[model samples]
Target: MDKQRDFVLRTIEERGVKFVRLWFTDVVGTLKSVAIAPAEVEGAFSEGIGFDGSAIEGLTRTYESDLLAHPDPTTFQILPWRGEIDPTARMFCDLTTPDGQPAVADPRNVLKRTLAKAADAGFTFYTHPEIEFYLLKSDKPGPHGLEPVDRAGYFDNVPGGTAHDFRRRSVRMLEDLGISVEYSHHEGGPGQNEIDLRYADGLTMADNIMTFRTVVKEVAIEEGVHATFMPKPLHGEPGSGMHTHMSLFEGDTNAFYEEGAQYQLSKTGRRFIAGLLRHANEIALVTNQFVNSYKRLWGGDEAPSYITWGHNNRSALVRVPLYKPGKSQSARIEHRGIDSAANPYLAYALMLAAGLKGIEEEYELPAEAEDNVWALSESERRALGYRRLPSSLFDAIRYMEESELVAETLGEQVFSYVLSNKRREYEQYRSQVTPFELKHSLDII
Candidate 1:
């Protein structure tokens, strides 16, 4: 730790970094930052910076608001978007109390606690997310309504076009910040795009997800366009989903792999899939936490709505990607239901906890649903023992309220706060009259 701190300080001086930003997230996944002068970086690493935590959502109560932001030196990176003049650097932080204990309400701490359990079981969780989002002409809907920067479809390469150039610039900036983006291309929806981040450990991946969002937005602004991760931003178009590929590792070996087993998936891998399938509904609120998120789920444009697992079945919640011969390390599963808008820390924690529980309990892996789940009738799906995910934020909250796994993983403070916050969001959404209602019901009713 001392060596890392020294390295960070030396780099700040050597790179002429004028400011170091301490970054953390609220329970709901909103990024919060505080800038400190380069001279204070050393002090921050040693003693941490203090702040009033009550101001941050789901952080603390008003009376017990004092908290500390301890920057993790390993996460240090210079802000490439800031350019050469008055350069800025940033690090992700973990919140702790005055006595130096991890804050129970901190989202990062929730993930850390979960990862520790996996480590105890001789495993490390790794994830790679295919994040999909849209670039709009403007932040707000214009006179002609919300307009995409381009009308290109999936994998469409409009050379020298807005989206192509935008992705080129974005990927370069991301690489400069040390984020390994494996692939980037236009997605199914017009003006929609997807970036596939290379796999990393759970904690690093969550931090990278947060940084990825910020970079996407910053690049969008620099190019005079707006980027949105809203799961279902447009009607009659495919929604943005963060289909996350996950695997477990035991030291250098991929714990999820087996040489000759079906799909080359090990027993540990099957149990992990069982855990995810069994608890996916309960964790849906955290993974897809907005009213808009349900729209993407039920809308059914490759966004999973049913809790089932199968090899190469995109409609199933847990999908085992087809294995490559002699490449056992690449064997993994993809959880298809999580939206890009989720709080990665909390979401990833719950996922790890649920998967670990399955392994601990030796949960039985069910029959694989190879057929298209979306095409099945409700009765047919029910006959096959397939269950639907929460249809709305209201339904998701109800499942979350009943989830022992979620409650234990998030701790009491965050569990209570998330429930309360989501309930309020549901209420606020229900009170509003939508354009659909007015368009259809005003004259008819």
Candidate 2:
């Protein structure tokens, strides 16, 4: 800890950074910060910056609001996206209450608690996310209404596509912030792109995700464009998703990997996948929280509507990826349904809970569906014991509200808060009459 503190202090002095932002996130995963002079960093290191927890979403209520933003010195990074004249730096924070207990409702705290459970079970959770998003001309309504900035298709490298430049800049910025990018490419939809981050522990990956969104938007704004993580942003095209690859570790050994096992996945790995599929419906509200999120899920193509696992089937929600020869460490399950807009901490917590439950119960994994599940008739799917995910935000909430696993996983405070918030959103969505209804059926009905 002293080493990091000294490193940050010395870096500030040497780099001539004018402001050091103490960054944290609200419960919904929106990044928040309070800037301090370099001289105040020493004090911040010893005692955290004080803030009103009541002001932050899903934080404390007004009565008991005092909170602390204790900076994690390990997260310190100079802002490469910012200007050089008055260079800025930042670090992620851990929240605590006045009495120094970890804030119960903090999203990061939620993940930590889950991780602690995994630690007790002698497993470490690791995650790598392939996050997709769109770069729009602007979010504001235009004469022809909202539109995509380009008409490019999958992997089309336009000579000077703003998307290409934006992605290059975004990836570089992420590297500068200590996050490694494995790959970046244009996606199926115009202006849509995917950036895959290298695998890391769950907590670090969650922090990286928060930083990733900010860096993407910051670069988009600088390039006179806007980035949206909205699932199904364009009705006719593929939507953004955060297809997460996950595995368990015991020290340096990969728990999911086994030599000569089917797809190189161990028995424990299969159980974990079973757990995810078993509890998938109950946790859908967390994975696909937004109203439009369901739209993407049900939409044809890569979006997974059914709870099934496959070796290589893109339509299945959970895919056991093919193992690369001699790459035992890379064996992991890819969860397909989670969207980019979710609070990563909460999403990850629920995922770990579900998977760990599978391990504990020794749940039997279902047969892999090699053929496309999407092509099967509804009746056929039913006969095969395949179940569809929640069809709407309301449906997801209905399932989540009754989940003891979710309640236990998120604890009392967050489980209730998320359910209440999601219900409110679903209610509002149900009450609204959209342009689709008006344009298609207004006169006909």
Candidate 3:
């Protein structure tokens, strides 16, 4: 830890970094940053920097607002988007109380707590998210109403197209920040693109996801295009889903792999999938928190709505990708329900916790749904014993409220805050009279 801290301080001075931002997240997963002068970086590492926790969303009560942000020197990276002259560096921080205990309300701490459970189980959880988003001509909806930058669909590489170049630049920026990009391609929707981050351990991956969004938005701004992670930004188009690939590692060996087994999935892997499927509805509020996220699930465009697992079935909530003949380490399950808009810290934590619970409990894997779940009728799906994910934010919240798993994974403070926050959001949405209502009701009623 000392060596890492010294390296960060030395790097900042050598690189002439004028600002070192201590980065953390609120309870809802929004990135919060406090910039410190380069001279303060050393002190920040040892003493920690103070911030008003009450001001941040779902962080603390007004009376008990004092919080400390201790920067994790291992997360130090130069902000490549900033000016090169002085340069700016950033580090993801661990939030704590004045007395130095981890803050219960902090999103990062929530994840860390969940991760500790996995560590106790002799496993390291890793995730690779295929993050999808849309590029728009402007930030606000214009006359055409949130126009996509290009009409090209799904891997269509037009010569000198904005998306092609945009992706290239975005990949470069992410690489500069030490995030590895495995793949980048245009997605099924107009102007929608997908970038798959190379897999990393859960904590590092959460931090990377946050940085990925910022880098994407920054690159979009530089290109005079708008970037959105809104799950269902455009109607009649594919929604942006963060289809996450995950696996458990017991040291260097992939714990999910079993040679000669069905789909080569180990018993541990099967239980993990069972845990995910069983508790998916409970975790929906965290993974797909927004009202619009439901649209993607029910949209029938590869985003999963059904609670079932299968091998390479996109419509199933969890799909085990086909394993290479000799490459057992690459065997991992892909969770297709999570939206790109989710707080990765909370989402990933819940996911890991749920999976760990399955392992601990020795959950039996359910029957695999080989048929496309979306193509089946509701009755057919129900008859096959498959359940649907929450249809709306309200439904998700209700599931979350009833979940012992969720309540345990997110401590009392965050669990209550998220439930209350979502309830308010749903209530506000329910009270609103939509444009669809006005357009139809004005003529009829």
Candidate 4:
């Protein structure tokens, strides 16, 4: 702690950092910040900076509104978009209460607690996210729909295109902030882009994801366009997903890999996948929290509507990527249902917990999907023992409500806040008479 604190302080002094932004997130994953002068940073390291918790969504009630944000010095990074002149910096914060207890509602702490459990069980969780989003001319939607900055299809390298330049700039900025990018390219949907971050530990990866979103949006606004992580922004096009690759490690070795196992996946790996499949429906409220998230899940461009697992089966909710020769260290399971806009801290925590539960209980791995699961008849799918994920936000809530794992992972405060927030959102959504209703039933009725 002293070493990281010293390093952050020295860097700030040497780089002439004027403002140090302490960053955190709300229950719904909205990024929040409070900037402090560099002089007060050292003091904040021990005492933390206080704020009104009641004003922020899901933090605390009016009577107990005082909260503190203790900056994680290891997360210190100079804001690339802020420029070098009198430069500003930022660090992720872990929230606490007035009495110095870890805030149960703090999303970062939720992941941290789950990670501590993994460490105690002799494992480390790592994740790689292939994040997808769209570049739009503006946030507004016309009668036809929102406009994409470009119409290029997947992997089409149009030199001098806005999306190409946007991606290039984003990758550079991310690198500047010490993030490693594995790949970047155009995706299937018009103006949609995908960037995959190199795998890192669960906590670091969640922090990186928060940083990644801010960088992308900052770059987009500076370039005179809007960027959205909306899972289903377009009706007949591919939806954006944060399809995550996850693995468990024990010290220097990959726990998921075995030399002669099927698909080279160890029994531990199989059990983990089983856990994910069993809990996938319940965790949908965290992984795909929004109502629109279901649109992406069921909209059929390989969005995964059923709970099953297979080697290289895109339709299956959990997929084991084909083993590459001499790449056993890279062996991992890909979860396809998580939307890009999810709260990474909470999402990763629940995912790790589910998989760990499977290991603890020795869950039986199910039959692999031999063909496109989506193409199977409904009864055929049912007979094959395939179960569908929740089709709506309310349905997801129902599943989540019954999960003891989710409640335990999120703690009482956070679990209650999330349920309340989603309930309010659904109520407001249900009361609205939409364009579809007006067009279909208004004059006819």
Candidate 5:
């Protein structure tokens, strides 16, 4: 008997769970679900639940539309929002073929596969994300677009404000679901909030991120406010970002730490940073996927525009925080370019791949930018050998299209589908007439 499977069954019976929701993500990181009666939970663990994949984004070809969702019992958690009456539990599912093989195009599987490669290399990856997002008054748009729940600025405290209440309720819900949050506070932008999740193994952190987005939105609905992970939701306002801190370990020893090195970063860590800088452009599609994502990257403020590493420099694409005394295990690098709206599974996979590539090839670490990269003039930055990340989604696509590393990491199924999907999206966006065009050129042209 499978202990975890049996534990899920016992919990369901003991907790009066009448519905079991099987959850997974599409290629673009949108959450998808199907609820089954309590009786079907056991069968779902063994035989798997069948679903049609014809319409799901980047899932598979429609000609062979059948797919199976095999629920991993380890992810089982009861829904807190769905009260005591017929309580619902959820488990994340892995997409599989009818023959019981892992589906190539499944974003979760893509992450799992990349993680396995790291395991083979005798390293374990860990990640912590400081997620930023905005809270709106409602989903409805006005002349000024969606209004914020509050106008609070960075770390501002507003007594009994909706943003405050929203964070409280959202944090409580996250805790109830077994996610540990390190901190929650007001961000720089109006009505923007940030919640930093404690570090966890890469796979677990990805799962936690998917759950976090859901809990925030659910609480927003209950509070009569709207929550968005959109990268650039408001014009002229700071955009939301999911800045991730990453590290690798060999058993219990942090591979990134050294006793007496510059920044206390070990040789392994330096190579890993080299890998990230070299491939940042190639993997930009997965990290900051949307066209609007570029607006945030180049929109100034805390958002990093150039590719460089530095100590405590938020203006650089990768920042190494000050090492805490007696906290050797905490030494890590923070990648700041990822927007809040990215698909966690694919994003994490490519990030791990990039870092590992650097280590494998013994890529030498570049010179650290001692001064602010964003403050430097164009010629000065070029003179220092710093490169800018993909300026737009178009440039990102061009870089990704020619990348062997990304193709191997994501597998052919996902690589082809993503390219196709993003191309269509870019074309569709270009075909539209934006308000900026009308305001600037409609009358003049």
Candidate 6:
């Protein structure tokens, strides 16, 4: 704690940072901030800044609206996208009640609480996300179509590619803000991109995800383009997903590793994967929260519709990358359904909780699906006892509403708020008319 405070102060002095933004996320994972002068950093750190929480979505009731945002000094970093004049820095924050108790509805706090449970179990959860998004011409909402900045496919290095330049600048900006990028390349769609982050502890990864989106948008604005994390931004194309690799560890040893085991997957790791497959349908709403999310999930382009696992199979919702000989630490599971638009805090919390529950219950692992599960007919899948995930936003919400594991993982406040908010969104969306409806019905009728 002392080291972080000193580093925070030293960074401000060295970087000529005049304003420091204390950032936090609401329940739905929108980044919110309050700027403070350099001289006020100490006081702000000691006594958190107060804000009316009721104004923020899914924060607090009007009567108990006053909430405090306490900055986590460890997250301090300079805003590289900002200009030299009055340069700014930012740090993620934790929201709390005036009495110093953690605010139940705060997404970050919810993750922290779930992490505490893992800590009690003597394990640390690590995550690395392969986040895919798009580089569009600008934010202009077109008439039922998206304008791509460049026509590029997976790993296509178009020289002088405007989208590539934008990605390079975005990567540099993220590094300047203390985020380590693993790789950045064009995705399997026109004007699509993927930027993967190095693995880190779940809480830090959540913080990094919030920062990553902001940096991407900031760099896009600076480069006179627009970047979007919307799942299925275009029709008849591969949709973007945040394929996350996760593992659990005990000190220096990988808890999920076992020697001489089939596929070198330990019993613990298999159970964890079982837990994920068992609960994935119930928690799908949290990971893919938007209406467009189902568009990606059900698009039949690599998205897994059924609950299944396999070795290095992209069609399964959970996959175990082939274990490297003598490399136990590298053993991990990848969840492919989560989109980049998810609330990382809630998503990671539920994931860890489900895995831990598996460990605790010693859940039996299922057989692997070698063939492409997507190619199999419904009867074949049914014969294999495979179950499909929720098909739409409303269906996901219906499953989420009854999930005891999800509720316990997110705590009551967040679970309730998320369900209510998503239901309302689905309601509003159902009431709205769309171009597709007009085109299909108006002329025909």
Worst 10 contiguous positions by lDDT, candidate 6: 137-146
Candidate 3, residue 369: how far the Cα is off, in Å:
0.3
lDDT of 5 by residue, 93-184 (tens): 99998999999989999999989999999999999999999999987898878899988899999998998889999999999999999999
Alpha carbon lDDT of residue 116, candidate 5?
Answer: 93
What is the TM-score of each predicted model, taking all chains together? 0.99, 0.98, 0.99, 0.99, 0.99, 0.98
Residue lDDT tens for model 3, 1-445: 9999889978987899999888998877888889999988888888999989999999998898999999999999999989687799999999899999999998988998888888988999899999999999997888868899999888898789899989999999999999999999999998999999999999999999999999999999999999999999999999999999999999999999999999999999999999999899999999999989999998878888889999988789999998998998898999999999999999999999889889889999989999998888989998999998999999999899999999998989999999999999999999999988999898999
Candidate 2 C-alpha lDDT tens digits along 28-59: 66788899999889998888889998888878
lDDT of 1 by residue, 167-282 (tens): 98989988998999999999999899999999999999999999999999999999999999999999889999999999999999999999989999999999999999899988
Error of 5 at 434 (Å): 1.3
TM-score of 2: 0.98
lDDT for model 2: 0.92
lDDT of 4 by residue, 353-434 (tens): 9999999999999999979998999999989999999999999999998889999999998898899999888899999999
Q: Which pairs of residues collide in model 3?
A: none
Which residue pairs in candidate 1 collide? none
Model 2, C-alpha of 361: deviation from truth (Å) = 1.2
Q: Score candidate 3 by lDDT.
A: 0.93
Clash counts for the predictions, in order? 0, 0, 0, 0, 0, 0
| Candidate 5 positional error at 323, Å | 0.4
C-alpha lDDT score of every prediction, in listed order: 0.94, 0.92, 0.93, 0.95, 0.93, 0.90
> Model 6 RMSD to the real structure?
1.2
Please list the residue runs of candidate 1 whose C-alpha ends up more than 4 Å from where it truly belongs after superposition.
Answer: none
Model 6: CA > 4 A from native: 141-144
Q: 22, model 6: CA deviation in Å? A: 0.4
Clash count, predicted structure 1: 0
